[model samples]
Structures are given as structure tokens and as C-alpha cells.
Target: MNISYQLTQGQIGMLISMPHNGQLIPDDIASTMTEKAKLVPDTDWYMDKLYDFAQAMGIATIIPKYSRYVIDLNRDISGVNLYPGANSTELCPTTAFDLSPLYLDGKSPNEAEIQRRIKNYWQPYHQAIADTLADMRQQYERVVLLDAHSILSHVPRFFAGKLPDFNFGNADGQSCSQALIDKVSALDLSPYSSVVNGRFKGGYITRAYGQPEQGIHAIQLELSQYTYMDEPSDQYNQQKAEQVKVKLQQFVTCLADFANAKS
Candidate 1:
């Protein structure tokens, strides 16, 4: 079997997590899914290419190997909703973002299968994050996590209209310090709209890992696909990516600086 994830170590106090970056759906699972499910449409497309610049900045990163259709890496193992009383996907999702059924009739994984996936896939990716953060905690005074994600510009299932280009979620100030939030809020986000603690206020990873009292901070940035790619075609747009990367660089630099700063 392919490794559960790829971990790129770095000499810094930051880790960039691309939890939904995987696009591969195993054949056994694929055989049970619908044609639309086979497409893995909800996968966060091209995040590896989008964040490729992080490697040169001495930033660590963790990206999983299997599509989220297999198991959502950002969700808690207990299968609690990240956003309670709101429309959300399951730990082992049964449908796509558009509410389309992912599996064929009665082909969804059973409880035992879900447990197997948790053991084989979810645990390793999260363990990697925990281990990396532990190591960074020992090396730096402050450790930061940037949970990177991208979504369709308009997913009516979740929200009414087009999403803000950049959605920053710090779990309503539970995940990071207000000073850091203020610093981020002060950045020039002209041309592209943004909102903090908006529709998406971080997921399990950010909430679980972020502990300001422990000198660890976390934030989730959910970018709209329209900002850097042709959403319909799902193709990379160099011009778009270049333009957005300028802003992204500033955003990440701020997070890195926050991590490396002395108390």
C-alpha cells in the first residue's frame, strides 16, 4: 500500500497542513462509487502546486495520499461535527459537497471499514502533525500551524452566495492570540474579499492543535478556487496563481514571522 502521507520537514516553527490535498481514490473504493464520486470533485485541487513556494521558506508541510472520499483527515475521530447544527460532511463521507451520493446503492463502507480507514489512513497523518508540532515546540518558543484549504467559489449547500476569496478561521479566537488576529486583519486584502471566523471557522485540526497558552497557534485559510484556478475546468491558471501568490506570500510571511517571534 502507498504511504498514508508525505511529510516534508523544515527548519522552522511552522507547519502547513494540506489535509484535503489528496486526489487519489483506491480502486476498491472507486469500484463502489458513482462516476461523479470517481472524479473526487470535492478534493482541494492543486494545493501542492499552490503552496510549493513554502519549501524554500524553511516551512514544514504534511499532505495526505488518498482522496478525502476515503476519509476526511481534518475531522475528529469521534465523528463529531466540526460545525454543529450546520450542514457538514461526515468523517467517512457518504456524499459529495453538492449533496450527491458518493457510493452506489448500499455500497457505503460499514462501521468496521470506517475503523480500518481511521487506523490505516487518518491516524498516521494526524500523528505526523502531532509529532512535528512536538518537535517544533522544543525548538522554538512559538509554534504556528497554517491549515491550508480551498473550496469552490459557490457551494450553495454551505452558504448562500459566492464565498469570500480568503476565509480565515481561528475558531472564533479560541485557536490563536488576538494580537496575531489583529496583525492578520490589518493586512492589505484589497481586490480580494476576506472574512475572519466567517462561514468556516477552522476545522478539527486547527481547533485541536491550536493552544495559545501553550505557545502554539493555528489558523485555517480557505481560499476560493476562483482566486487561483479555473474552477470549472479545474486547471491551474498561471496568471491567476501569480497574482494571488503575491498576497499568499504576504499572508504566510506574517504567520511565519509570528511563529519565529520572541515572546
Candidate 2:
């Protein structure tokens, strides 16, 4: 069993990744965290639930079992900042987005511990992604990858004011073909705001594996949690969730069709 994550094969040559959806914290690690950190507020709460429709769409999906506090799989294993100039989080973040300490005083994971987390958590997730794509690529010439994520609407540490409801990133058009991007960019972004290649222009997973020239295209979508969640409380809003999922199903279906046509 791949204890690190859950993966399912797709019939449509597409993969959806939710790296931060994990909320499990090993007791050994939780013992070192602050009271607030133990709650795992930084998690992409309920993302697996939010994107559950992908499974019905025959889109392969993968979600990690451990919290990002264990290791940020979206981040580079070397701990390089995906956005160098901006305030960014690390592979094993010692502090929360609000600059609050996640660990107790001097109880943070050190360099050695960070490396251990990478080996234990990060490596497995990426290897599964690479391995699955390798197997799928043999059958399908071009496979589309959708990296899904969500965040609080107003994270001052990352952006000012409220964030766009839908933030699409394709590593600034290098990760996917123009045809794929145009299709996603042309979505009916009414009522909700959206921007392409804005504050978040994709992360390690999109940049590292997205080789459009090599017949692998990737796109990262960052949604505002307000779109489907009641924040702080994480109450399930079936009405809000259904509305968003309808829109997502349309987008993913278009993406899959576009990738095949381009290939």
C-alpha cells in the first residue's frame, strides 16, 4: 500500500493532484507543534471533498495522507522558494502564514528533520505522480495534469485585499499549450473574479513536471476558500459546493478534450 497518498487511474488521460488536502499529523510531530498548529488550520481543508467530482469524471486523483506541516509536497525538495522575492512558505514550515510560530519555542524541525520528512513524505508523493504518468503516457501521448488548491480569501502575507475567486496558473504559459490555456482562460468567470498567471503562477509540481514540449501539460488552479467553505468552521455548504463543482466539471471536461485534440 502507498501509505503516503491515495491515487486512482483515469480513463481520460488526466490527473488531478491535491497535495495539501492531508490533515493527519504523526504524534511525534504533533508533540512539537503549538496548540494552534495542532489544529492544522493551514491545511487545504476538505479539498478531497471539494474535488470529489473529479473521480466521477474519470480523472485520476491523488491526495496525500499527512498534513503539509509534515512536508509540503507542492514545494521543491531542495526547499527553494517557488516565488523568490515574495514571502513564501518552506517545505517544512516553522511558521504559519500569519507569521505565527507553528512549533513550540525552539521545538521546530531542524535541517535534519526536514530532510527526514522529505524522504518519508515528499519523495513518495512525487514518485507516485511520476510513476503513474509514466504508465499512462505509454498509452496516451499527452496527459493533462490539474493541480488543485484552495486558500483563505484574504491572506495578507501572500496578497493584498481579497484574492480572486479562481487563480489559474500554467507556469506563465510554459507548463501547458496555448490551446489548453485559452480554453481554461475563456471560462465563464462571472460573479467570481479570476486572473491568469497572477500572484500564483504555479509551483514546483507544475513547473517541474509540466513539459508541454514533451507531451505533458500541467495547470494549477488556486481557488478562494470562500467559494465553497464557511471558513474557520469548515461547515459543509452543499449549495455552494454543488455550484462550484458544476463549473469545475465543465472546466475539466474541456481540459481533457483539449489535450487530446492537441496531441
Candidate 3:
């Protein structure tokens, strides 16, 4: 099946992505998932709306339509786990963060099916991202890739306590220029203090695609769902979301400006 991508062409300074916000499940796979998995609770719900400001600011975005449970587009295709020993979902997650089985009895994808998914869904999503960056680099001297994501404020399996409002990960400074990182850090989000290269020190996409010396910078922003969504329900709160969006706009615009100037 062809993966659908949303692309908004701009001057190509930075390319923003919402890889996990999708909810579309292929019919074949959907039939196998339990009711709980069908809810797609672990999705980065409403991330596309959260970053809608990108289009307004002339920043391009590439978002997938299928859910991460189908195939985690952000993961390494070689089957290597992003978190190593730490708890993490697979290419096609069999269970949720709460350890609930996603698939019904005897319906999970086997090795052959998994390989088929990798060829069909996983590879194309990443190729699109790589292509966008390549195009951006050709047009501009420097490009920044902002991988947008969100999670529940507290996932005990991953962290000890509630997470900070904004968790910026740049693969321990290997993904981007120091200036780009500093620009994001300078935002006056004092009320919601952020952590740079913390628990989520970027994902496979951020680490693999980022090449500072090559002038293709990448960073992952993991926002706590509480900052914008009503947890458990996954409802969007306009008032609370607007407050956060304003800061995000500022953060993204700064990166755009920095890229424009540097380019």
C-alpha cells in the first residue's frame, strides 16, 4: 500500500515532521488488533494540528497517515531498538506502553509479514524525509529538521516522574549545530522549563539523518501531552494549546530565521 504524505513546499530552510500522529490502520492489520489497540492510545495525537503554525510560517512538513503501531517510521529499518535495553515498541508493536497485547490471538505478523511491512510502509516514509532534506540542502547552505512528537506526561516504564513540558533531543549534540540548539534553548518558556538531551535524547530518525558537519541539522521535540491535550481522552484544549502554540511558533520562527541568515 502507498503511504500518504502531507507536504507544504516552502523556501526549504527547515523541514518539520509529525511521524507518529497518524491513526490509519491497514484493513488486514486492523482486523488483528484488539479493541484497546484500535484506539491507538500511544499515538502522538493531534501533533499535526499542534504544528499547523509551520505551514503559516512557510515551513514545510511531512506527516504519515498510518499509525506507528502499523510500522514505526521513526525506528531503524535494520531492526535495532532505539532505546536498547530500555522499554520500546517494535517495528510492528505487539504490545502497548502499558504492556497490553495489541493483536488478537494468533493474528500477529510473523517474520515474513514483518519484512513485507518494512518494504511497504517503513522505507518509503523515511525516504520521503531524506528526499526533502536533500532538496532543502541543495537550495540552502544549512537546513534544520525538527521532528515533532508528544507523549503522556507520565509513562512509568520510561521515566520516574512527570516529564518536563518540552524535552529537546539532539542525539547529545551530534545532530545539529550548537547555534540551532542555543536558539531553541533561549526561548523564555520559564513556566515550562525544558531539558536538552535528556531521557529522550532524540530517536532513530533524529540520530541517523542529522549531520552537523554536512549542515543538515536535526532535533526532536517531545512535548508532554498535558501541555496541550486532555489526557486519557486525548482531547485538544484550545486555550491551553494556544498558550503552548505561541511559544512553539516563536521557537520555530527563530529556527527559520537562523536558517535563513546562515543559508
Candidate 4:
């Protein structure tokens, strides 16, 4: 199946990527997942809507259609753990963060099947990202990539306690330019202080393609579900979401201004 990409009318060519917002499950894969997994509660619910402002600002975007459970596009295809000591999902997760089995009994994909899934799903998503960056590089002198993500504020399975409202990851400043990071940090995002290379740093997409010297900058914004959604469930809360959107708009707008001024 072909991957999907959404582009805005921006001459600036900044790319906003929502790699984990997808909720689609292929027919074959859907057959193997349990009812709980099919609900896709772990998804970055409504992230596309969260970043809808980007379209108006003429920023292009790339969003995957299939769910991350099918194949995590943010993960390292080489199978290296994004978090070494901490628990994490694999290239094709067999269990959910809650430690519940995602696949039906005896229906999990084997090694060969996993390889096939990667070839079919994982590769294309990254390819779209790569192609977008290449195009942006050609069109503009500098390109900014923002990888969007959301997760439950409290996942005891992964971390010790509740997470902050905003988690900004740049692979410890290795992913993007200091200017970009400084610009993002300057926002009055108080009570939402960001961690540079904390528990959840930049993922595969942020680490692999972010070349500051090459004029391509990437940063991952991992928002706590409480910032927008109702945690532990996938329900949408308009009032709370709007409040959060104001802060996020400031965050992205800073990046846009920085990119425009720098470029």
C-alpha cells in the first residue's frame, strides 16, 4: 500500500511529521490483533488536528496511515533499542505498554513475518520523510523537521511517575541546531519545562535525518496526553485541548519565526 503525505502551501518548506498518529490496521494484521489492540488507545490521538494550524501557516506535513502497532516507523529498523535500560516497544510490538498481549493467542508475527512487515510498512514511511527533507533542502537553504507525538502522562510500565506536560527531545542537542532549541525553549511554556535528552529523547526519525551542519534540523516533541486528550482513554476534550493549543501554537510559531529569520 502507498504511504500518505499532506503538504501545505508554504514556500518555507518546513515539514511537520506525525508518525504515530495513524490508527489504520491492515486486514491481515487486524485479524491477528486482539480487540483491545484494535482500539488503538496508545495512539497519539488527534495529533493531526493538534497541528492543523501548520497547514494555514503554509507548512508541509507527512502523516502515516497505518497504526504504529503494525510497524513503528519511529523505531530503529536495525532493532537497536531507543532506550537501552528502560523498557520499550520493539520494531513490531507483541505486547502493549500495559503488558497486555496485543496479538491474539498464537497469532503473533514470527521473524520472517516481522521482516516482511518492516519491508512493507516501515521502509516507506521513512522514505517519505527522507524524500520530504531532500525536497525541502533543495527548495530552501535550511529545513526544520518537527516530529510530533503524544502519550499517556503516566505509564507506570515505562516510567516511575507522572510525566511533564511537554517533553522536547533533540537527542541531547545532537538532532538540531542550538538556535532551534533555544527558540523553542524561550516560549513561556512554564509548568511545562522541556528536557533535552531526558527519558524520551529523539527517536529514529529525529536521530537519523537531523543534520544541523547540513542545514536540515529535526526535533521531537512528545506531549503528555493530559495536555490534550483524556488519559488512559482516547476521548477528546475540546476545552482542555484548546488551552493546550495556545501554548503549542506559541511553540511552533517560534520555530517558524526562527526558520524564517535564519533562512
- Whose TM-score is greatest here? 1
Model 2 TM-score is 0.97
- Per-residue error at 253 for model 2, in Å? 1.1
Where does candidate 2 stray beyond 4 Å?
A: none
Rate residue 35 of model 3 by lDDT.
94
For candidate 4, the per-residue lDDT at 36 reads: 92
| Most accurate candidate by lDDT | 1
lDDT of 4 by residue, 36-100 (tens): 99987678899999988888887878888888889888999789998888889988988888899
In model 1, where do residues sit more than 4 Å from their true spots? none
What RMSD does model 1 have?
Answer: 1.2
> For candidate 2, lDDT tens digit of each residue in 1-263?
67989998778778999999999899999999999888888788778887777777778999999988888999998778899899998889888988899999989898999989888899989999998777777878889888989888888999998989889999889999898899888888676789999998999999998988888899999988888888746666788888887777778888888656643
lDDT of 1 by residue, 194-258 (tens): 99999999999999999999999999999999999888667889999989988998999999999
Q: Which 10 residues in a row give candidate 3 its minimum summed lDDT?
A: 1-10
What C-alpha lDDT do the candidate models reach, one value each? 0.93, 0.86, 0.87, 0.84
Clashes of each: 0, 0, 0, 0
Tell me model 2's lDDT, rounded to 2 decimals. 0.86
lDDT (tens digit, per residue) of candidate 3 on 1-263: 34466666776579998889889898888999999999899999888888887877788888888899998888887889788788888878999988999999999999999999888877787888888899888889888899999999989878889999999999989998888899888889867869999889999899999998998889999999999888867899998899998888887888788778854
Q: Could you estimate the TM-score for every candidate? A: 0.98, 0.97, 0.96, 0.95
Question: What is candidate 1's CA lDDT for residue 113?
Answer: 90
